[model samples]
Target: MFSFNDLLTINGISPQDVAVALHKPANTSERQALCTMIDEDFAAFNAYQSTHARIPEATLKARGIMASFVMTSDGRMTFVGLFANAGSQPFAQAGPHVYALFVRMTRKMTGPDEVNGRSGLEALQNRLLFDLSRLDTMSDLSGRLIVQDPGARNYMRVADCTPLPVVELTKEAQMTPPVPNWDALVLTAPDLRKLPNSWRVQLSAWRGVYLIVDRCDGARYVGAAYGSENLFGRWSQHVAREIGITKELSQCDPAEFQFSILELLSPAATADEVIGAERKWMRRIGTLEFGLNT
Candidate 1:
């Protein structure tokens, strides 16, 4: 049987680093006791191998694309963390593949205890940081993610064991052409939450007419921002309330909402003018009859 050390050697991690990880205390309470965890992770991994025959061999040959399987034990979700080429090359040279981003798929949690930090996927990276030492190399790719919730099952793995579809992060996002106008910028609720600081600065500078389109039901809500904080401030209010002006908005999943600017007005725009534009939009879209506007 391959002890953790033998597994590390097969995964291309150095002996010196392996020794440090095993003996070192990751934190005050938990020492780096990864030997058994690694075994368990692999056992889960191997269970799927009957279908993915090449996973074990391919993982050895592929140098990039590290992965983590974050499974919620309660059968609510299965989060897959895909690093472009995490272990195939040196850390510094891996380019954008070095950073980690998490995706949450499926049911919502009832409390913060379900996740290590604040509820939602936003805190996923922070949770991953707690396991930084174990994720140091490809050998530790499949470390178990332990959290306060027994319902959460988090494990990191090489991309090879179960090849997941890659979301192009680095090159494509950079290559995306900039939106020429604020009216053209469309944002999802999650995108708005992750809105860049620079973009927020520009948005905060003006009042505007905006639209909230619910992707799930094709409902539309027209609203205006003419307050002192301007469009950015108004949107921040939406984030704060986490709902829209209508009863429909209050009930619908925020993930189903898409926000966009209809028209941008000067900072001097009055509240009446903003509201007038909003009403015009509602009328044009028949939001009061068919959508969420009240």
Candidate 2:
């Protein structure tokens, strides 16, 4: 029964004079743009909102908007901040009639690195992304405030100046769970890419042998990490490959693959030692003759 503008009123905002902007990016490139912004690229995110295709004042005035509430897709339409429409100007040589909308924001949630959600992976800050447990109250501005999904895609609209009703508040808080034990992880390609930074840091610090199993037919791939990024770097690159892993798995579907750690090795482990462990796993798992390692 609690609402968004109600939270605004508590913050001294007169909802009637405000417009609420919902940013739920659906395309891959747009999603990635937003992801980077929330994680470590605040300046870029700021510039992104500050510059935009201009919306005529006549159009804005027709709607009685004098201020703005911009929310990004973090699992739900979680409010990131409020801005004043300082007006617009041309952006580079980009052709006519085009303009940029500059805004000054007061952030309400914690920083992206302090968060552990899918947003860093392009599905997350468009990803307040996780646990807006404080929705009905405004005592703590550090936690994100959730607005009920408006159910429409009109990115900008007049605010009701009251509570925008929510169906369920906690459903959208999906995120990485406590980093988990290494052996307990069984990640999909999408899962790997969307993991939070803390987990990636841990993976980056270790040298290890890992496994990729094709879910489609139980075909396996055995790989080792001893170079720069260690397990994190190697695995990230593996997931990032568009066509396939090595030339051997080219004809297979990458989406059907699941990733996991087979054995953890010391960071000081030599490349030969790592590969030696890899060979052992290959023999144990029968991955060389029947799996995807070439």
Candidate 3:
């Protein structure tokens, strides 16, 4: 029944001072609300998370968010980083409730710029940022995270959080858990644009028969991916076009399409093998007779 707050205390950080930034970018709107840090550079991603917060400065300073327990929400949460918070300034260039910059504290909240405005501490402050590797040493709380659902608030006080136990922990959390394998893969039209790198890599090397169903009316399109383009590239064509490939789907919004794998093939699968599978799926699914396939 050990909790994340317990982990914080063991590291010598009081539960009272730290506010965990629970990043739960489960959908398109959610991802946009949070800075899209996953696509950012290595060190820069943590820097982005450090400076970013949707909570107002008053609440941040009032509750004393000296560090952020960076975790992403996508079903099983993954711990990303533990960043020491210094102080935060309003995001003048952006909308309200978002901070533009956060002055960061060192690992133990001891540093010069920890006061909000100071010089020459960026490199030193960045060193204070710790990733999952540091957390893994505490207790083997990595494989398959099992904590109580961290509710809707994106940020919470560690003091208020101590009562909640980290139900179970076994392995380090991936930036994203390995997305469902191809058999379980289902992609929203919006996901294609912001596809997780893990998913992009899987699709990049896969050649397969795929299906696109209109989210609005359930009209399905069976297609195939082969040659140099692969499934990733082929799926892109659906969204990249203003008008879809078929006469039926062209009348419907492309964003209304849902993409999924119909049948997977090896990278060594032949063009004939791919197209033949595509035909098999189309016939079995009745795409040619009643669906959007052309």
Candidate 4:
């Protein structure tokens, strides 16, 4: 029979503080009215629970995570919530858990009206779906339960499963004669800043070394690196050093460039083995190829 006001009191939060944090109108009179509405809503929920007694324990547990509410410019209000599991604790501690919930509530509260034109109810449903989706994505739970649903096959058919577009590389100048039966190495670095945010590093790394090249526009020669913490920096340095090498070898020269990391294998792995794995993974999840001019 615990109400939201009671929960807030237990958590040491006040309705006025919630309104101010949520950026609700600073008008004291309006703030008091909203708090009264919230109290009434909680009282009704408590009455409903007394009659039905059907609320799930998980739902009650989730309520504890919502710390505040925010009113959007369009009059929609959102409830902010948070969840903490072991893996996320480190990142969460870096910021205020309550503030994060406020941001979430602000985003959800401002959306369009739903069925019956009830903003609060619709926002709550959307928040629930958002939380459920996060749990589903992170959990190791298989789709077996979903598959058992009556319309499972129909649902699967409606789901889109398309391949990502591939970036094509042209062989302009073969400065270094291709090694006979050499394995192509693919490496990936998710954090490369210069490359298009969408562009992932895909190259082969073998024997503690890897080659990177320009996949887009093909205007630069590529370089290789070994045992570097900032592969992007090392690759850039290689490009600068090799700018002259490419110009000297191929008079019709484009600038040499460093490759980003998309796929990298430690020195312990064989080049051929890494290339094979790279090809398999790329086939499944599309990757860009880097030119290894250096």
Candidate 5:
């Protein structure tokens, strides 16, 4: 039966003072005192660190204190506290308001696994502290884009951008035209994996999508076969034959030609939605490639 007195003694605070700071009436001192006790206990529990050593003072200042108790959707007790702020006053003065805000935020953001069947306030406290730290680091870009390299297990901030001018080495160099192949194109394993196993029944189905990409100063065609399997092999062969015949007979050597299967989309999905998603990915990949090349 831990009580407000216990919390006050541990944190060097008085129960009555906590009540006053929290703006709870002394007549309901027991309830106010209990709330303060829980808040302090959770805060201290979250503050402890192991491998990371001490938490930075600046981080604490920014995110405020964390707690070891989290409120659940079903109104049950969990030993996990989330990142929290105590406002700009002592626990007694700001405790109630902060606790209410913490409860509200937890209800909105967390799922059942996070707030259920947990004990050991320290564990909950530590998890929340780590989360807060990560969020703070992510948000502090300092006006630059922050990207993570999973292979290297590190992060980098890109700050500068300088474009290189496209140059033509020879004055007689001519722009090569593209050769479009009406035939089928070969798809990669990743592209093939996008379609479901049931798509094999409809062999002639080609309602997927296509894109024109610039690769190595040449145009490359990419197509996807939605709800279709074994289509990539047939399409690739067809495309190769078409390109071979057309480029060999053309006066101007066709620009380097290549093709790939991007991805399969749902049958009901719209072209605009699919294209929007593709464009977003392309932009990201293009930015990374440009940065690496430069």
Candidate 6:
């Protein structure tokens, strides 16, 4: 049958000094591209060997050669990184560690299927998280290469040279200004639960006028938030109920709804001021006359 040896032959590498054959499959295109990038960028390092070597004594040396292969989640092989540097540490034990690399997939890799499954928090927790601690669940790096280091080994080369995507947390994002135009913040119904705590906190801090446009039709709804609950709190209420308070939104599929903040009000703004802004927006947008703000 096909084996690692066959894989090596296909790639034109002699399989003699190989320490281990590692195969990890990345199901998404984003991941597939990363595999290619890591291999190309680190080719020289991957080719270096220990002192008992024939090649030039290079600055970077690989402890052992490893063949990294990536495939789709369904097992369709896509990319491979031959002889990638095995990081010093093999498995992570605890977290709050910064991931050197990461990618934002179109959907969570660890959750249940949308069609026949409940979209619950627990299901979301099942996906591969950036801050990983468990080794058994290494499936999160499903299509990436991993080595057990059969023996405790160290290479003279650079450590942790894997190309990892930089991650900017929600708190870090808050340090930057919000969208210059407040209305630029848009969300789909499914996006609400995924909001980071920092983002939610910032949203809840603002009492604002917002719009929900039904993309299915060109109809829109203008609304306001001025109560003890701010924009975030109001959105949380919308997340709970399918229809919300608007008949048009309730009748339309959640996928057809796009939510945006039209205006931000000061925390000290009175209820009258918030509603007045909402009404003015509704009048300007003609939502009350032809849209969904009854």
lDDT of 5 by residue, 128-178 (tens): 223232123212211121111112211111111111121212333111111
* TM-score quality measure for candidate 6: 0.45
The best candidate by lDDT is 3
lDDT string, candidate 2, 17-53, tens digits? 6665556655432443354345554544554443323
> What's the TM-score of each model vs. the native?
0.44, 0.58, 0.71, 0.22, 0.19, 0.45
- Output the lDDT of residue 125, model 4: 30
Give the alpha-carbon lDDT of every model: 0.44, 0.56, 0.57, 0.29, 0.30, 0.46
Report the C-alpha lDDT of model 4 over 172-291, residue by residue, as the tens digit.
411111212224423222112122211112212222223344444443332333433334445433433323344322432223223333455564655466556545544443333432
- Models sorted by TM-score, best on top: 3, 2, 6, 1, 4, 5
Ranking by lDDT: 3, 2, 6, 1, 5, 4
lDDT by residue for model 3 (94-191), tens: 33221222332221122221244434233333222222112233333432445555676545444555444676565554444456788888877666
- Highest TM-score, which number? 3
Q: How close is candidate 1 to the true structure, as a TM-score?
A: 0.44
Off by over 4 Å in 6: 1-181
77 Cα displacement, candidate 1 (Å): 29
lDDT of 6 by residue, 1-294 (tens): 334344445555455534332223233433332233333333211211111122212322233344333332233332233343333321132122212111112122221123232222232332322111112222223233222222222222222332222121122211112332456677755555445444566787889899887777767888898876698788766656556555656776655567789889899999999999999999999987798776
Model 3 residue 6 lDDT score = 76
Better of 2 and 4 by lDDT: 2
RMSD of 3: 9.4
After the best TM-score superposition of candidate 2, give how far the Cα of residue 11 lies from its true spot, in angstroms: 2.3
RMSD values for the candidates in order, in angstroms, are 15.2, 9.6, 9.4, 21.5, 24.0, 15.1
lDDT (C-alpha) at residue 255 in model 1: 61
Per-structure clash totals for the candidates? 7, 8, 6, 15, 11, 10
